[model samples]
Target: MVSKAMHRIDQQVPVLPIGDGVARSARQQQRSPYLYTDDEIQRILHAALLYPSPKASWRPVTLFTMLVLAYCAGLRGGEVARLMLGDVDLREQTLEIRETKFFKNRRLPLAPGVMTSLKHYLVVREQAGAPTNPESPLFWSPQRNCGYTVGGIRLILTDVLRRADIKPARGAVGPRVHDLRHTMVGHRMRDWYKAGINPQSKLPYLATYLGHKDIRSTLVYLNITPGLLQDACERFRKNGAAAPQTRESLP
Candidate 1:
């Protein structure tokens, strides 16, 4: 009998990519690393404005107003829900943001459109038989016979997001109600840069606008690099050249 030659069978092994970067990138996509982009934000706002609430006998008008106020005021959902008729100063074009987080309250200016939209809302609110007291909440559901709570506001946003197909991932994860507040601050910083405002110098103002007790909280929202980085680079280039040796010289 001839001895059979021993042969090795090749084992099936999966081919793996050489670099781990691809896997890392795939993991990162699973994470939300950035706020909504401008276009995405606009879509979000539009969807919010179009949200159909059972109590929206005015045809979702309150949803539109809420989105505008949330965007323009940088106000959190709690603050938005808590807003009262007298809190707004129509003549001064300012809103008195009261009893915010950290025991802080502040006054914030309003854009013309925000003021106008609110006035229009007030008209409809009166037509809908809203309470006559300025001390009462500005937002109340005729159907619910109560003011809109933070949960109510969140529900409206959640509904809108679902309708727009922009809802966050399930399992109690993803974007939050406060994200809109952060988004507004980010948008404000973007506009400030576009208008050539000194971001550092005006940080306090932003904090005040958002009713932040400290400037640091406000800075968290304006976390993007475009304005701050660009300003720093431009300032560096200018000072790199000879103008005044002493500090405190800028036009």
Candidate 2:
């Protein structure tokens, strides 16, 4: 439009800087996800449990449970923050995630170990005089007297990450809270490879487990890490050296 206006007036058209094109291209590329190792996760959990908060007596246990649920359940930060006490069914060992990213609800079964952790947290929370009403927030903050907002969860996790040495204390460039979801997917795929299970066949189930609308969205979270690569290579070699079966022996 500027160039056309200049042409009408018979004036010179100023050239735009080439840097705009370069910046636009950079914006279009997806940032690489940071995958946390099992050891790093343990360290973060330990740090969260030791986090200091003078106002909130239940802070330590709440933060610890929040991180565990986010990773173990492959839940988004908002999903974790929005969880209500009613959504967690200890008897059934399941969590009902309501109104997720795709505006769909999903119920996830908890592993035995995860259920044990939740029970312990609930016990401690009750001792701390936190609310036990079904409509109460699963993880509550004394300061807010309500469920944590998405931003609040991010701020807490950022501090824990810094304390765990998983991220620099003062930098914006580091692993994000959302990376926990990505790490969960990558770890699951690697475990499947190690167990000689066909990960390709499990993709759909994994997608649904993560509350993804399709496998393509889930694929974005599957980072190719060194451990995953090694396991995949080992699986390939084992299959290659296996004895060939006759057509009559095929299942």
Candidate 3:
């Protein structure tokens, strides 16, 4: 714009063409998400539970519970970090995720097992002298006396992943904290297939549960895996044979 104005003011001024000869940079390929198996998830959780820290007694349990919520509830790391005490309702078995990505708010029903785990964590959190006020962070950092930051959550999870032998000690290539969300989606779809349910029909519900603006956004997480493929293939085989077939005469 400055160049254009200068050229307008002075006929002698040359407005060199911008981006005329420049080649557009190639779009970087997005890394394939690592879909975690049930055993791998258990290992990661176990590593978190055993994470040793002398100053913060609540660290181990806090990390464990956070991972559980991330994987089981398909929560984004920020959503997990931003949870307030009042957001969780043990009696109702629900979690109220406040303003998140795209400035959206959502409430999610917790599975019974997840609720039980959370209840156990709450007991531990209270024992550790965490503030019980409704506004206080659910996953409090005793050292900081505040909620864990999104970056902090990722770093901690990375360390746990290393301990669990799920990732290299020093590298960017590994199962990320965000992969838990993908894993949750993949696992849920696989389960639906095994149960003889139509996963396509359930996509919108999953999208809403994950706080996605639309099913298209949710579709990115549904990477085909061996187990999911097997179940899907089985479903197709059984249903394909029974599907009504019509004969059409050729012109």
Instruction: Give the top-scoring candidate (lDDT).
Output: 3
lDDT per residue as tens, model 1, 130-188? 88697988886777767899998987776666666666645335555556777776766
Alpha-carbon shift of residue 88 in model 3 (angstroms): 0.4
User: Candidate 3: TM-score?
Assistant: 0.85
Q: What is the C-alpha lDDT of each candidate?
A: 0.71, 0.86, 0.89
Model 3 / residue 142 / CA error / Å: 1.7
Clashes of 3: 0
Stretches of candidate 1 off by over 4 Å are 1-34, 53-55, 169-171, 225-251
Which pairs clash in the backbone of model 1?
A: none
Each candidate's number of clashing pairs is 0, 0, 0
- lDDT tens digits, residue span 20-80, model 2: 6676657535557889999999999999989997877678888888898889998899999
Candidate 3 deviates by what RMSD?
Answer: 6.4
lDDT of 3: 0.89
